[model samples]
Structures are given as structure tokens and as C-alpha cells.
Target: MLCEREKYDKISEESNRKTGDDMKIIVSGAKGQLGYDVIKRLEALGIQAVGVDLPELDITDADAVGAFVSREKPDGFIHCAAYTAVDAAETEKELCSSVNEKGTLNVARACQKNACKLIYISTDYVFSGEGEEEFETDSPKAPCNHYGASKLAGEIAASENCDKCFIVRISWVFGVNGKNFVRTMLRLSETKDELTVVCDQVGSPTYTEDLAVLLCDMIKTEKYGVYHATNEGLCTWAEFAAEIMRLAGRKTKIIPVASSEYKTVAVRPLNSRMSKKSLDENGFSRLPAWQDALERYLGILNEC
Candidate 1:
């Protein structure tokens, strides 16, 4: 018998599409990588967008969040703000929880009050790094580290507080506006002739530019729920490092090392392979292959 994938209720065609010059959307973490691309994309599409970040907005402050939302009165809010330092999260558990969970709750409440569509960006770390099988949207969440646990809590906070929220899980994201693996690899190649990278962990790399396009598409429709979004292919860290060298014409060699050889403050998930059936079913398009994305990324770097 075929293993049946549990399906989610299909997104109906009843779209409360946001249009016109007066249309507005607010983006959290607008200074970050994904948010930068998203705001750029929105402007390209002729949509009015406002970004909130840094000293102007502290999401953990309920009053600030509420006032901001009330003032903007946006049709949609894309929440990309997060405490992303993986290893640091282990020691800074309290801060991580406050930002990822409490901050998210504040945002969700604000969104609910404004009747705004919320998009909460999450990570694949919520799963244990056990097997090689791809993780489904409804996969059991057994986060092994503090960071993962906090993010999982954030997911719950966002979903529970806001009825019109989209929980989008992504992994290995790279982009032009912020620091990412591609830039790090290229920087390392400038000095080192060889590098040892972790080979055990494998996942797809998400290009923020591509992801931003998909997000814009989602904000247009009211099909809000949980989903996974990433580039179309997968690779180990070592393989990805080697590809970076190849693209940039660097002679740096990549040596594959097991997870045990590399020590970190926090545990990492090995099985970050997420199934995109949800996106396909929800009438969303998958991102381009990682290899294609990497090449374009390097090209962009070269021009810069």
C-alpha cells in the first residue's frame, strides 16, 4: 500500500486581493535580508509598503507594537524579525525566548486587532536531526536545542494569537542584503586554500530574492496557514561550499567532515529536508534549484 501523505484543506479561490495605490503592507525586520528583498519586491509591484525595525520598533514591547499597527493600519504584515544566532541562543535562552515568543505574541495581537494578515517566518530547526526522511509540514516537533524550542514557541504564539496568520518554515537562507553562507565561503576562499565543512547536515538553500517573490504571491491571497518554502534542491554543507568555490573560480578545496568533528554550542537538525507538497497544493510555486540560485548569487556578488 502507498503511504498516503496527510493533506491540508485546499486554499479556496476566494481572494481578498490587495490592490490600488492606497494599499499598504508593513514588514518587520525590514533591515534584514528577506525583509529587504520583500520590500524591494513590493515596490517593484507598485505596492505601498512601510518597514519597522531597530530603535524604532521593539516587538517585545506590546505598547509599541500596538501603536505601530494602529498607526499603519496595514492590510498585511510580514513578520521577519527573529533572534537568529543559533549558538548564542543556547546561552541566551531567556533573551531568545523573549524575542522569539513574546515578541511574536505582541505582533500577533497587534495584527489581530488591526484585522491584518500576518506572515510568520520560521525555521526547520524545530525538528530533531534524527533520520534522513523529508519532514512534512505536520511533522513531530522535537527541538533538541534552546533556539529551536524558542522558535517553536514563537510559531505557537503567532498561530494562536492571530487567526489570519501564515506560518512559513524555511532553511539555509541566503540573500544579497545581509550576511549569508555564500558571502562567508567567498571571504574564506580569499585566504584559505582549503576548508573543512560539515557533511552530515543537509538541506535546501533559500534565496531571499526568490522567496520574496513567493511571499508577495501569498500575501495577495487569504490562504493563510502553515507551509514550507525553500529552493528546489538539497546539499550537504561541504558540497555547497565546493559549489561556491566553483562558481567564484576559487581554487579552495572543500574537505567533508562529520558532525562529530565539528563542535557547536547548540545541536543542529540533520533532517531539514522539508516536503513542499503544501506549497504545491496551495497553488504556490517552488523556488529555483539551489545551484541556479547560487550561481546568480555569486554573479550579484561579482557586480557588487
Candidate 2:
């Protein structure tokens, strides 16, 4: 059996054979966890991928985004930059809307003018956490929090502005390039004997390294529409944490708590289970199971 890195290399090599080597893609939020991985995957597949973020580019500034897109004239624009501070978004509604909603609009418009395919990274938060059922691509959107609403608005902006758009909604994302729940859990286990995690919320985790391959594959094709992408299996946060401890060979115990008992500034969705039927319908392969992805992620962390 091949390790995750070896498997990834094989996948990239096979994908490279099917894709145009001269394809150019620009990734916003280049410094972010997802954006960083997407660019890496694109480059690995022999695509000319450029990353732009922060002081170099501001997605909120329409003129700046337009000029950058026009100058680069990329074949595709992967927009990953957003205000993702879920709890902080409540107190910073204006800023969140500016970065997520307005900023996404700017990127979409730039892509439209440049005739570039726009791949907008979205969240599963667009759906209401009312039931235990999985959310489909056409599910009714009722954001549970400000951040969700902002991302939902961004979804609308991307679809409305860019004719050629792909909106991929992912949940519980973890990656090597930045901070995430998995890293936090490992870091806490080093000093703490136990940690409390919410048990009510359920969702599949998305490893950026795995998602990057899927995203790169999508960018090469003309499958333009909405899709939900996450690892295969699902688990509550507490269950996820316990599995993390088990995999990492840690002694830390994960104490499960009902979401109602553990109050938060922003209400997290109770049901983040999303259907991957869209990916199947579009001839795209689903990501590996969450457990498998986590194990691979831990191995990568150990090497790093």
C-alpha cells in the first residue's frame, strides 16, 4: 500500500496526463490553507498556477482585482480568500460582509471580464442545521450565523457575476499550511490531559491535500455548477477528537458535550452532512474517508 504522499504523487501524475500542460490558473487567498494547497496541486499537474493574496492583492478592492486578473489573464481563478473567523464574525459583521460577499463579487467580476473560469470555495453553512439529513447541492440555504450568511452571499455573487463558475461547498477543513481543529487538538494534548468537544455537530472533514486533487481535476474540465466536497465518512466533533487521540497515540481524553451545554458566540450548524451526488453526477471521484485522510495528515505532520 502506498503512503498518502506517494498516492498523491501517483494521482497527480495520472491527472497531468489528461490535462493541458499550458493551462494557467490564479488562486486568491494564496497564503491560506486551501489556496496554498490548490496552487501546489495545480503546479504539480504541470499547470501554470499563480498565487495572489494580502498586500499584493485585495479581493475587496474591485479595481485592484480587475487589474490583476486582466494583467495575468489566467485560464481560471480559484477564489479562496474570505473572512472565516466564525465567532468573530458576529461582532464584525461589516468587515465579514466586505471581505466575503463584496470581495467575492470583485473576484467574480474580474473573472467574468477576463473570460476565466471561476472556482469559488464555499462552506456547507449555507444550509440550516434543522435536521440530521444530508444537504444536497440544491438544498435551501438558511445560514445559522453571520459567517454562513456572508459565505452564502458570496455564493450568490459568484454565480450571478461569472457565467463559468464552480461553487464547491466544503466543511471542517484541515490542512498543513495553517491552523485548524486537528492541529489545535494535537497542540492541546501536549499540555492538557483532556479536552471538551461538542458532540452534537456532525460533518465530514476535508483534508486540503486531498481536496486539492479534486479541485485541480475540476479546473481542467468544463463542469460548471455547485458541488459538495468532503471526505467519505462523518462524525461528531467529539468522536473526531477521540479518533485523533487514538491515531496520534496520545493519552489525552476527549470529553463530549452537547452543543446546547457548550455555548458559543456564533451558532455552529448541527448538521453539516452534505451529499456528494453532484460530484458523482459530474464524473468526479470523491475524496478518501475522513479517518484515512486524518491518518495521512498526521503522518505528514510527523514528517514536517
Candidate 3:
């Protein structure tokens, strides 16, 4: 097997030869689940990536963002930084808006100034969470919570500020680098014999590793527009927990319950089914099924 540095050189050389473009990229929120995976993917492709997070690079500070972008002058900018505390955003609306909206605007503006392609990571919460049919890329947005509203505002800011921008919305995300549903389920099962999960709310679970690769692929092309990218297929939170227990060989029973049974500070969307037709029409590679992603994630977790 090739060493890390050797793998990086091989991938980077091949990417450069094929694309004929230097792969210099900047990733915000570099320590986050998605951002960390994205940087790893870029490095595997032998691309030059600079990862920035809070304290190092504050996205809410326009001058700081501008200075950093000007200094780096990367070919692409992946804006993964955001205030993602869904429930806390209800009371901390200003902090959420400042990070998700104003912070995104600052990054978008920097991309515009530096002539860099922008890839802004968004969320499925932007929808109203009431429909049965899958939401199209142009579906009307009516965010039901402050977190969702803030993210939607960020999306709008990205579009308005940058000409070459791609807004990729994901749902039910899980990764090794951060707290997610899979980890939570495993932890709960350790302490409890049974758990109640909402069956009414449905959405796809997106593995950050898969999403990172897709984001890298998007930056390679000029398919600059809104797109819905998530692991294929959908299931309720109860169903998801059941699968987790099944894979882990845990005997914890998952009781199905309505969304009302579990009250949260913010309302979750009932339907997070987003159509990937835009990805197909735009000639982008679609992600594998959620089951496959789950299994892969579990395998990785076990090894760790």
C-alpha cells in the first residue's frame, strides 16, 4: 500500500494531468464533519487544500475573510462553516443568523473578489417539511425553524453575491468527525434498553465521506447552480435507528412514535425527500443508497 504522502502525490499528479487546472482549494469549517471529509478527499486527489475554522478564520468578519482569501487566492472555495445547532437557534437566533447568513455572505463576497468558484453547503430544512412528493431544486422554501431560516438566508446570500456558486443541500448528515444520529443511537443503546423515535419525519441520511467526494466532483465542473445531494432512498428516524441497531447487533428496541411525542425547540420537516433529477440532468454522479452508506460508516466506526 502507498503511504499518505505517496498517495497524495499520485492523485494530485493525475488530477492535474487530466483537468489541466491547478487544484488549489480553501475549505471553511475545516474541523467540522463535512469539512474534514472534504479536505481529506481533496488531499486524496492531490489537490492543495487550506482548511480554516473558528479562531483561525472567522467567516463573520468580512475583513478577516477578505484578507485570508486574498492571501490564499485558491481556485475554489468550499463554504462549509455554519451555526448548525438546530434547537438552540430558537433562542440564539442572532448568533445563528450571524454565522449562517452574514458569515456566508462574507465568504461569497470573497469568492467573487478572488474569482474563485464557490460551493456552499446547505440543508434540507429549507423546505416546509409538509409534502409527500420529493422537492425539486426550485421548490418553494418555507423554513419551519430558525436554523432552517438562517440557512435559507445563507443560500440566498450566496446566490446574490457570487456568479459562480453551487448550493448543495443535504439531509440527516452523519460522519466520524462530529456528533450525528448514528453515534447518538449507539450511545443511547449503551445506557437504555429501549428508545422512542419519530416515525412521521422522513429524510435521507447523508454520509459526509460520500458528500465530500460529490462536492469535489462539483468543483471540477462549472455546473454552477442549486442541487440536492443526499444518499438515495428515505426513511423515518425510527426506521433509521432500527437499522443502526440491526447493523450493530444491539438488542435495544426502537419504539415508533409520532413527531408530537418528542417535543423539540424547533420543528423538524416531515418530508425531506429531495429529487436528484437536477444532478442527473446536470451530468453529476449520484450517491449510493443510504443503506450502503450506513454499512460503510459502521465498518469504519468498528475499525476505529
Best by TM-score: 2
The TM-score that candidate 3 achieves is 0.94
* Candidate 1: Cα lDDT at 210: 80
lDDT digits (tens) for residues 31-147 of candidate 3: 999999999989887789999998999899999999999999999999988999999999999999999999999999999999999999999999998879999989999999999
Of the pair 1 and 2, which is ahead by lDDT?
A: 2
Which pairs of residues collide in candidate 2? none
Q: How much lDDT does candidate 2 score?
A: 0.92
Query: Is candidate 1 or 2 superior in TM-score?
Result: 2
* Weakest ten-residue segment in model 1 by summed lDDT: 3-12
Off by over 4 Å in 3: 1-17
Better of 2 and 3 by lDDT: 2
How many pairs in model 3 have backbone atoms within 3 A of each other, for residues 3 or more apart or on separate chains, i.e. clashes?
Answer: 1
**Backbone clashes in model 3, listed as residue pairs:** 12-46
TM-score of each: 0.93, 0.96, 0.94
**Residue 257 error for model 1, in Å?**
0.2
Root-mean-square deviation (CA) per prediction: 5.8, 1.5, 3.9
Judging by lDDT against the true structure, name the best candidate. Answer: 2
Ranking the candidates on TM-score from highest down gives 2, 3, 1
Where is model 2 poorest over a 10-residue stretch in terms of lDDT?
3-12
